[model samples]
Target: MNELVLPNDTNALNNLMGGRLLHWMDIAASISAQKHCNRIAATASVDNVSFKQPIKLGDVVTIKAKVSRTFHSSLEVRLVVWTENISTGAKAKSNEAFYTFVSLDENGKVMRIPELIPETEEEMQLFDGALRRRQLRLILAGKMKPDDATELKALFFPEI
Candidate 1:
């Protein structure tokens, strides 16, 4: 997805507001999730989004999203946001995040999504990290016991 940052999309400092950028990211991620699942998907959560650089007005914002992994009815969509200065022809990485989405049937019930086989090395890396990220998210949401997150145990207990 590509968006032209206009004056209305920026804050007083002429930088694109975080909320607006988030909204665009959600749309791009939703498209990716829906395309993979072949069903409507609702955003379940947004992982931490750190703004590496500010996107100024008149910049062309490009959001690249892909299905990094799928579990049950939920899928993790990896998103990368970059900004290009039209006048200077310079591009910079602005933000990166993982958005979770649950595919739903026409009746709005969660439906199983298809599996994703990552072919490239970069895709494989993203696919491998999704489990740890999901475990962390579940632990933070209080939906899973910390002890059950085997993938996240290494962070606190390195010897494991």
Candidate 2:
């Protein structure tokens, strides 16, 4: 997704507001998920979004998102945010985020999705990283107990 920065998105300090940036990120993420699933997908969660740079007004914002990992009924989407200064045309990395999306059927229940096909080594690496990140998020959110965490660690990080 690409957007031209406007004055309305700026705050009193003339910097872009975090809320607006997040809203855009969500939109882009959802679109990417839908494109991957080829079906209706809902935003399940967002984890560990960090803004590394400040975006000022008149900076062109570009968001790139892709499916990082897929589970039985969910997928993880990783997004990278970038900004380009209109005057200087210099591009800078702004932020990155990981989001979970759950696919739904006509009745709005969780549905199974096709198996992910990773064509490149980088895609395989992304899948591994996203799985690790998802497990970390689950542990932090209390979704995984200590035993469960230990089991996952054994499965994914035995070398550690």
Candidate 3:
């Protein structure tokens, strides 16, 4: 998804507003998740979103989103945002985040989602790391015990 950083989308300092940027990211993430599952997907959670650069007004914001991994009913969409200055043609990475979406049926119940097959090296790395990320998310949300986060525990305790 690409968006122009118009005046309305910017703050008093002429930089893109964080809320507006988050709205755009959620849209991009939902589209990716819905397309992956072929169902109506809703945002379940948003992981750490760090803004690395300030996107100035008149810049073109480009958001790339893809399903990093899928669980039984939810999937993680990794999004990277970049901003390009229209005049100077300079581009910078603005932010990166992971969004979790849950597929839903017509009755609004959670439905199963399709699996993601990572073929490329980058995709494989993201796919492999998604499990640990998900486990941490679940643990933080109180849906899973910290000790039950096997992948994350293994990562923190390499000798285990």
Candidate 4:
């Protein structure tokens, strides 16, 4: 997903606000998750978000997201943000984040989702990284008293 950085997305100094950028990232992540789940996937949580560069008005903000991992009915999406200067056409990395989504059926209940098929090495790497992040999130949430990464890993991954 992409958006042209406009005045409304900026602050008093005309720089893009982190909140607005994060909102867009969530939208992008949801889009990617929904594409895979084919249902309503709501944001269950967001992991760390790091901004590496600042984007200004007139920059073409590009957000890329893909399903990195999944658990019973939850999906973790990895999002990368980039910006291209409208005039100079130079692109720079902006930020990155991980979003967790819970796929819901028409009754608004969590439903089973198809297994993620990692087609390439990049995807496999992303899936592995997302698994680590998911574990960290679970640990932070106090869901893992034993602090076992494998226990947390089992939550979002299927035995192949």
Best by TM-score: 3
lDDT of each structure? 0.96, 0.86, 0.95, 0.87
**Which pairs in model 3 have colliding backbones?**
none
lDDT of 1 by residue, 1-160 (tens): 9999999999999999999999999999999999999989999999999999889999999999999999998999999999999999999999999999999999999998999999999999999999999999999999999999998898789999
- Report the lDDT tens digits of candidate 4 across residue range 1-160: 8899899999888889889998999999999999999889999999888878788988999999989888889999988899999789899998888899999999999998778988899998887777677778888898865447874556667581
Residue 59 miss distance in model 2 (angstroms): 0.5
What tens-digit string does per-residue lDDT give for candidate 3 at 1-160? 9999999998899999999999999999999999999989999999999989899999999999999999999999999999999999998898999999999999999999988899999999999999999999999899999988889989879898
Candidate 4: stretches off by over 4 Å: 151-160
lDDT of 2 at 39: 87
CA deviation > 4 Å runs, candidate 3: none
Per-residue lDDT for 9-38 in model 2, tens only?
988988889999889999998998888778
Please report how far candidate 1 places residue 76 from its true position, in Å.
0.2
How many clashing residue pairs appear in each of the predictions shown?
Answer: 0, 0, 0, 2
Reference-based TM-score of each model? 0.97, 0.91, 0.98, 0.90
